[model samples]
Target chain A: MNEPILRIRNIESFYGPIMAIRGVSLDVHPGQIVSILGANGAGKTTLMKTVSGVMDPEKGRITFDGQQIQGSEPHKVVQKGIVHVPEGREVFPLLTVDENLSLGAYTLSDKGQIDHDRDLVFSYFPVLKERRGQEAGTLSGGQQQMLAIGRGLMANPRIMLLDEPSLGLSPLLVQEIFGILKRLNDEQKMTMMLVEQNANAALELAHHGYVMEIGRIVMDGAADVLLQSEDIQNFYLGVQEEGARENRRWKRKKTWR
Target chain B: MDNAQLLISGLANGCVYGLIALGFVLIYKATEAVNFAQGDFMMLGAFVTIGLTNTEYMGLPFWLALPISLMIMGALGYLIDRLIIRRLFGESQTAVVILTIALGFVIRFAAGLIWGHEPQTLQNPLAGKEIRFGGLVLGMEDVAVIVVTILLTWGLYVFFSKTKLGLAMQGASQNQLAAYYMGIPVKRVQGFIWALAGVVAGIAGILFAAKGSVDPTTGLLGIKAFAAAVIGGFGSLPGALAGGLIVGVIEPFASRYVAAGYSQIAPYALLLAVLIFRPHGLFSQVRVKKV
Candidate 1:
């Protein structure tokens, strides 16, 4: 019943002459974790890009916290308290971890507040604090991802768009990271829109879930509903049964186009 | 006076080359574009200083005219980024490289038209003065050059590591897209970097003019500085100074011991040798881009 913090309505995005996303609509309410699950080339990443103002959509509207922000640049979008932890964990390689964290608070001028927020980040990722003086490229993959998320947190964002935090991590590490994310959301009331291919882990953590196929949302409902559905189990969950494989494939194939 | 004196003089000249090389590395770091017009900017700075101080031109005194010329070149640098360089965003690397080379010629010819082709001496407070110690003698200007170069290099080092704005510029230079996502105004930073490069080049130009004379062809000195940058690991700040000193010392020593013609090609030969052996230069840290 809570009002949505971010609302998307029939948004279409294109790369050159090819359409990357079409009529993709979703909602993220206050303090809720919403996950978008899709395979490669299904436009999941493109949706996050459009929402974070990295690319302009050709049609429809994107409203973040009740303001129209469809075509704004990434820096302007960040000013509105929408921090994006982009895919591949793009940390500045040559910079020290401390320098990276300091840059995250670029908009803020208050030294005291910046220091306080940096300490908070250090608390969340103790490894970052210990390796603060080391170059960011020296950190392991898991630590770099943590630093990327921590950098996003330093901005004091109202909402975070996380793209594949567990892209190349071990299963145990994925669970560990998702556990931290859940605790942060519960304790600090942080809103998140996660794009993921790991449906089981994502659905276990997120409150709401949307299934994307070929640049459009195919099914969306409460996380439990989507997780329990028989179709998601066969295709996305990869727990396919011999009896239903052919019928499900034909039905899903028809719905795709 | 002797071979030792020649070495000392060569080292002093190397400091000037290093200053100009710093200008090249500054613009290259910020925008990833090798500015071919860097030497031309230095040439233009000297001409501007001379014109401002010339009684026939603006008639201002040397002290008053120098600062004004620096300001003018700084503004010119900012305008170059805004009016020309920005349009080449996302262009092919070759196109941008060629454009800058072409721009260097344009500025050089424009100076030729305005100032005439004749060489003119630049008036300065330290002209023709030297200090004698034992059998060795050093020009006052050489001492000034060495002292000023050290101070400028130290100042730049502190600015990059300590100050907020300088850190922001460093961060942006490393990754502009990431910097933008962090809410750093990257375009404005690019403009500031270009202006800063211009001011540094102006200082080097003024010093070079005072060392001898300014002519339209003076900008060709940028080529030697460019060779120094390549030897120093193009993006390394301190490497620029080291490379310049190496090039400067080698030129005079080669002419004195080897052949008179060897002076002109010594830096180029050293650059080639370095590129063949260690392409990244001695002090450069090799960076691998991650996906």
Candidate 2:
């Protein structure tokens, strides 16, 4: 598929002696939204951290655009056009919204380009425009998520890695943000690697989807196929059989089940 | 005019203390460490200037000697971070605080060895000069101190708010990991902050020396500056200056009017009062982040 823009092979990352991501491999092609669906402890965050060089993999090869970037420093990785919009919306609370976006473009040298990128981000999340001068801490949870994504867009990244953009937001807000992600993918042809627990929304917009279970990938397929699969419907999408309530403990499992 | 005279002198003293306190706030905000060695940097700054301006030492002109001393102090600060503080990464902030306190000792000892235990003053063009207008009389040195301190404080406020590096530094101070994600070199920015604090200490040292005499023990003045930082609300730059001024203005009045032996406790007394009443000092920053 036109040589996937990011290639991760046998990436084994750890938290000290505890292996969090165990020899998992995946690919994300250019101009495509690839969603990695997993439960809370599925190592999705760790995988994103490894690719963005926040946490170095204990053993693996991560090549972006055919250059090794597995163990590079986070800033160096950013210069190579990999932006990680980390979980929990870690915006600089004391800084103004404009200031936060400006810092996201810290790797870029051209001032004009920075201004243009800022304008582009403002267009995507016009609410951020309304609160450009407000301190980021004052933003609502939904707006903070938008600011986080807008900050990533300020980088003009070749590929953006988003860890749980739908996290800690209302379902309505989640739908709105996912709709924007869909728009960005269609309009700007933005390449995004989205890690999410909201399987239904993520798969609905993603070009391809992979289901991860406890640090390993159990299913990978076209988004539509994965959406219709009985395993995905039962486990991820929570689409139980007719008149069957998903109330039991230890009821659903992964592909193996 | 007697009180006016007292006020002018107090303001000048407060300016110096505030300048030093600014150094404290700069370092604390970036690294979350109380740099007890900050006053030592000031002492070394004055010693360096004295070494340069006095004919018996470097014999350099004041103009040449000033920038040179600042650069030297800046390098010392950067080196301290690169060589010492960076290694303390992943360690507790308390460890950094203790390390800085120990460094203060080293600095005091080193100054004693290099310049001798006797106090020395810088030979400058401004000392012993005065300005008089109407009922108020002010020392030219004091006037210079007040004017320069205002300028420096304003400059720092602008730098933090207007410049790109300054904003990045602020972002890094607030969230180091997110700053890294934004492509900011957080560690190097921290090193630069130390360098900036060093330069500030040097300028304060030179001005303090011009105002009076300096010895190995001069750095202990940083203690009062620390009090000023706390009084300034810890996070606010203007607050630091106001805190310094508050401490400075009270000292003379306390010694002149209060009971004997209590004059020495005046600044600390004011600090205690402020802490008890304001709690967040007279000026808190950014309004608790709107949570």
Candidate 3:
């Protein structure tokens, strides 16, 4: 029964004149991982962008930490401690890895705390320390994603919004990334709102999940219950066998109240 | 004057051109818009020095007046950014360029009205003093230009490569949005860079005036500086200097041997050739945009 840290009420966003996101609402509780599962063009990225203040929503209210944040500038939003790791791992390509990390702490004024966070980020991604002098663009896809997340951490945010950390990574690397994410959530009790196309994987890791289809949430429930449901099996989990569906139905019935 | 002396004079002039080009490149890197008023800024700096040194006015010594002029020009640059350039933020690239061009006209016309069209000579403390060095007679002013240019260029190199503020400016130039996310106050950095460029241009103007005369029409130095910027690859600081020197040296040689009438056009011709052969300029880093 913890209070929610973020609330979105009927928010709609547009790109120029074209409506990209319809009235979408969700809640992210304190110290919980909430996953927004969707296919491409389902407005998942748009929703994250709106929350991070990159795109202004045309309608609805977004409250973070009890303050209305809709339509705020991106930099101001960042100062309020909602750090966004944007899509495409947009790390400053020309900057050295260490310099990139320093930029993440741009809003921070304390020299000691900035150094402490730098150490924390380096420990989380040991490879970053090894390649701190190299340009960020020189890193591999998995390493860049780690840098992006590490960069988000540098903001000392209350919540981290990650957009497809698995995008463009190999299966093994994706697994490694998700493992780190789980560790951050479980060990540090860090709050996260992850937008991912990998629905099965995202649902498996999330405490609660919301399925987005064409700019609206179609299904939302506890992750375990959704994982056992027949609808999720057919539409998201890609299970077609009759025997498997029957077993999933039984598990759903048992898991549901 | 011997051929060697003419070559030395040309080299000195080239150094001034390079310094002004550096100013253009510095501002262009930060804002991505050429301040067409760059030359007028230089002219203003010289005028301020002229006013300070005039017997009827404050009549400050040349050494004191020089720094004061530079400081005033830097402040003027900061004011321009706050008043005009900042308003043009998020404007289309073409609109920004056109606005700057208009600003250039405004500045030049204003200077003409204020100072009148007469060319005035700046009194040189070391005027007519020439040093003989193995078949080349170098004027004291020429030596001053070379020494000052080298020192300024060196200072700039250290600032960019070593300082935190310098790196932040570079980061802002590369990606403004990303720079802001990292906590760099992008607007302040842009203003600082404009001010820096103004100071550099001011130094160039004072030197140029010492060697020759200062008139409202001296703002034409901007066209040569623009050519230098183009030659250096519009965003590269060192490239601007190199480009200026190239134009400076080549124009005089062209005037003496090739065609006196075409001397003024030499830099433009080089600019056209560079554009055709190497669009990025001789020293610019090639930038690739992501989809």
What's the TM-score of chain A alone for every prediction? Answer: 0.95, 0.94, 0.93
Candidate number that wins on TM-score, 1 or 2:
2
Q: Is model 3 an incorrect, acceptable, medium or high docking prediction? A: acceptable
Write candidate 3's Cα lDDT for B1-291 as tens digits. Answer: 566776777878999888888888888889988887788788877777888886665689988898899999899889889998899888887887788778778877887787677887677697778888786678899988888899988998889766778877878887776676555678999999989988988898888888888888788788888898899899888888889888888888889988888888888998999999999999987645332
**lDDT for each residue of candidate 2 in A207-256, tens digit (9 for 90 to 100):** 99998888888889999999999778988887767765566435353343
User: Candidate 2: where is the Cα deviation over 4 Å?
Assistant: A242-257, B286-291
Ranking by DockQ: 2, 1, 3
lDDT of 1 by residue, B41-157 (tens): 999999999898877778798999989999999999999988989898888767877988998999999999999999987777888999899898889888788888888889988
Docking quality band of candidate 2, CAPRI definitions:
medium
lDDT of 1 at A26: 93
Q: What tens-digit string does per-residue lDDT give for candidate 1 at A1-257?
A: 97899999999999999899989999999999999998888899899889888789999999988899999988888889998888888887888999898888887788998999999888778899999999988888888899889988888899999999998998998998899899889988999999999999999999999999889999899999999987788678977666544444553664432
Candidate 1, pairs of clashing residues: none
Clashes of 1: 0
Local distance difference test scores for all models: 0.88, 0.90, 0.84
What candidate 3 gets wrong by more than 4 Å, as runs, is A241-257, B1-8, B61-64, B123-136, B256-262, B287-291
| DockQ comparisons of all candidates to the true complex | 0.60, 0.65, 0.35
lDDT (Cα, 0-100) at B252 in candidate 1: 92
lDDT of 3 by residue, A1-257 (tens): 87799999999999888788999999999899999987788899999989988789999999999999999877778888889888878787777888888778777778898899999888878999999999887788788889889988898888999899889888898888899899988877889999987778888889999988778998899988888877788666878746544345433443211
